[model samples]
Target chain A: MLKKRIIPCLDIKDNRTVKGINFENIVDAGDPIELAQRYVLEGADELVFLDITATQEKRKTLTELVRKIAAEINIPFTVGGGINSLEDAKAIIESGADKISVNSAAILNPELITEISKQYGNQCVVVAIDTKFVNGEWMVFRSGGKISTGLKAVDWAKKAADLGAGEILLTSMNNDGTRAGFACEITKQISEAVSIPVIASGGAGTREHFAEVFQETNATGALAASVFHFGQIPIPELKNYLKTQNIPIRI
Target chain B: MIAILKYNAGNVTSVENAVQNLGYSTIVTDDVKALRSADKVIFPGVGEASSAMKYLKEKGLDQVIRALTQPVLGICLGMQLMCDSSEEGETEGLGIFDAKVLKFPATALVPQMGWNNFTSLKGKLFDGINLENDCYFVHSYYAEICPDTVAVTDYILPFSAALQKNNFYATQFHPEKSAKIGLQILNNFLKL
Candidate 1:
């Protein structure tokens, strides 16, 4: 049986792991390698690194950081943000990320998803959609939620799946940064709409929230940043809680 | 020397990284001679079947791969291509395993992607690894359970998670990306 994945998302700024992390065991919180090693120790199924410094100049730095992380971590990791082209995805893959997550670029050019997956495999391409319930319907968001694509969130997920995207990383902008719970309604809708795996990202406050996403919907994975970075919910314990709930989570 | 066959598929970089972590030097190449002469060959992939098979046939490396007698390990798509045929694109495989690959039914998620455990482990490839330990898997297609199957993993249906026949070994899962237990499986293969 394929266990529901537990993923930890991190932010990288100028080649440093930063954002809401406060751990004394970390030699340098800015160091993604150190933090990645710790996540491995915590029994995380996978890791997501969103490069905050995704500028063209620092794109090289992100690749280098990926190489560093891949060296120390054996588990699958994804590198996202600023992935604007096939070449960009290639560089990151060459740097050793198991997969590449595309957001704004994928929205701007829906064909980009097919092209990247064509060049690389669909397994290498993860289309991340930031959706928010806007104007009575869940709409796709871009530019860090400032712009809306006016497309229904579930419809967009279906489109991405048709475009040969192996997986969908659906992030609810409204639920994001809130410790309430996942946007299960939209997640369940999208999961049913597509045959591909849907990874629910955003608003994972408690271990139950993770369980809720997996139970309420067909979400194959759940991701959170603050909850993990702050050590509010240790991954090992979270997996334990989900396991006891009869959720087949990776232990 | 360890050689990881590189072609149209992805995941070679990750495979190389894992091999190096195992303390063995490796080369990611499609070169004919290097592949033939390597002490051990790791055939790893992540791509469409027909296109990948086309790339292999075009490079003329397919024949070289077919001829290698050393212990050759195939990972994921690499394992799929080693079968007799695959339903994906109706592609014909290398026939090493005398098995055919089939897509998981849409009733369940197409790609049963995540950590799934193994049981009924056999062969040196899985030696010393707990049969209950979960390993990472990401694939829409699965190889059928055959006589060569050394391990079993049940998703919507039970299938060959790991297969071995003579010198050729393959896994439906990505052992390289499967964490510590995954590394142990790779180590077992290296020793074999």
Candidate 2:
């Protein structure tokens, strides 16, 4: 059976790992490479580094960091944020990152997803959707979750899958940093609708929350930032708990 | 020297880094002479089969790979292309392995994109790895169980996790990205 994955997301800003609350109020956690090595030692299934750096020369710094982390860490990792073109994707992937994720860029130019997928295989293209509930409906947000694209969450996910995205990284902005739980309803909606794998992100507070998202939704992976970075939940202990709960997890 | 074949694919860099991390020097190249003369060859790839096959044919790596007497291992798309055929893009493979690749059924997830364990392990690749050990996988098409199958992993159904015949070995999983167990497998291959 395919085991559910517990992924720790590290938001990167200028080559350092940081965690944000509700997409704001960022704080330094530690060195990106050191944190990556620790996560691998702690048995993180996979790692995701979102380059939250805002600068004209962001690409050089992110790629350098990616190269360093890739040289040290053995597990697969995805690099995202500010990757607006095929060239950007190539730089990170050539730097040794296994996959390149696109969120707001995909919405701005949907063809970017297909282009990257065509050049590299679809397996290396991850479409991350940051969605917030608006007017009683989940609307897609771009520009770091500050702007709304007015696209339905499920519809955009399906479109992304059609556009050659191998997996969907669905993050609920409304539930982000809340530490309540995952957006099970929308996650179920999107994961069920698409044939591709869905990684549920945002609102992961307790071990039960991870269980709830997996048990209630078809999400195969759950991602959180602060909990794992702050030592609120150790990955090995959490996997053991999920095993006790009858969820298929890799220990 | 270990040579990682470079031909219209991804993960060549990752594979090189993994081999180098294990204290083995590696060269990522498409030159026929370099690949053939290397002590071991790693055919690591991630792309469409038809396009990959086309590139291999254009560069004449198809014949070079088939004639090499040295140890050769393929990963993911590299493994699929080693088989007789693939349903992806209706592409014909290199006909090295006796198996055929097919997409997963609609009843299951298209791509098994996480860690999963394997059973019925065999061959030098499993020298230290156990059934309880899981490997990272990210693919939709899988090679059917055949005479060359050395290990099997169940996802949508039982399929080839690793295959071996003579000097040619292949894996459906990404050992470069599978962590310690993966490194163990790579070291096993290197020692062989």
Candidate 3:
């Protein structure tokens, strides 16, 4: 039985975790390694470190930080953001990352997904798509939701799976940081469209929100940021709640 | 010194790093001489059974590994290859253990990934680790529990988590990826 995963996502920039109210007003959280260790102890199923800074200074810092976190943490961790090429994905995985996630890179060069999957197994490749509803149609976003691509979210997801992406991490730009709930409609659409596991991200505030996402959507996991960071909901308690709800959990 | 038999399987670095963390030097080698002469052999792999067995035969490591008198520990695919046969690739194994590795039914999960508790452990590998302590796993094939099964874990059904027979011991889970309980298992194997 595959257990449903509870992941705490950390947005890294210049070696520090930066969080915003709604993808703006970024505030310093602390060192990524420290926060990672804290989350593990608090029963986080996995961690995702997204290097949001596209600058060279942040890239170097993220590479070194990934190695540091891999050395200290024992659970599976994923590294994403600004990963544009096969070499970037390889470097991160060799540095002890369990998986490498590509967002804009995949949309730009869809072949990169096949190339990376060929070099490293598909299990090591994750394709993340940032989506927002536009005129009753789900659209893909790039550059942290700054640019919108007219590709339908579900179509792109299916194409990613066909290109050998092991998993899909679908984040809703409209609901991100809103803490309202997941964009369950799009999540369900994409999840039903692909054979690979889908991890639902964005807009989770309370434990019930997680339950709603897992139950209402076809997501294999639920990833959040502010709620876990502010200690509003502990992972173990959330798992307990899900367990009572008859959702499969490791505990 | 520990010698981890390296072939085409993945996750070799994780094993090397875990051994190094325990203060033991490790060499990832496919050389039969290095593996045969090492203090202990760690056969680690993550791939299909048939292709991996073909690589071992091509390197003539299949013979060297079977003749090793020192304790040899196999992880994941390594454990499956130590058995008599595997349903994956419809291949034959080393036959060190009287078990057979079979793919999980498609009705069940295709790949059983993530952490699960081990029960009925009976070896040095589970030394300080409790029966219910969880260990990480990621595999589609499993070895049925036999007389050699030292520990068991359940997903769709009961399967061997750890197996031992004389000098050969194997685990179906990735101890190197299993956090504290994983490190403790590695420490116990190092002492052995």
Calculate the i-RMS of every candidate, to one decimal place.
1.4, 1.1, 2.4
lDDT of 3: 0.86
Best by DockQ: 2
In order, the Cα lDDT scores of the candidates are 0.87, 0.91, 0.86
lDDT of 2 by residue, B1-192 (tens): 999998886658789889999999999899989998999999998878888888898889989988889999999999999999999889888899999999999778877899999878998888988899999998889999999999999997999999998899999999999999999999999999
Using DockQ as the measure, name the better of candidate 1 and candidate 3.
Answer: 1
lDDT of 3 by residue, B91-132 (tens): 999999999999887554346767788767887778888876
State which candidate, 1 or 3, has the greater TM-score. Answer: 1
Correct interface contacts retained, every candidate: 0.83, 0.86, 0.23
lDDT of prediction 1: 0.87
Ranking by DockQ: 2, 1, 3
TM-score of chain A of each: 0.95, 0.98, 0.97
Question: Alpha carbon lDDT of residue B90, candidate 3?
Answer: 95
**DockQ for candidate 1, C-alpha atoms:** 0.76
Between candidates 1 and 2, the DockQ winner: 2
TM-score of each: 0.94, 0.97, 0.90
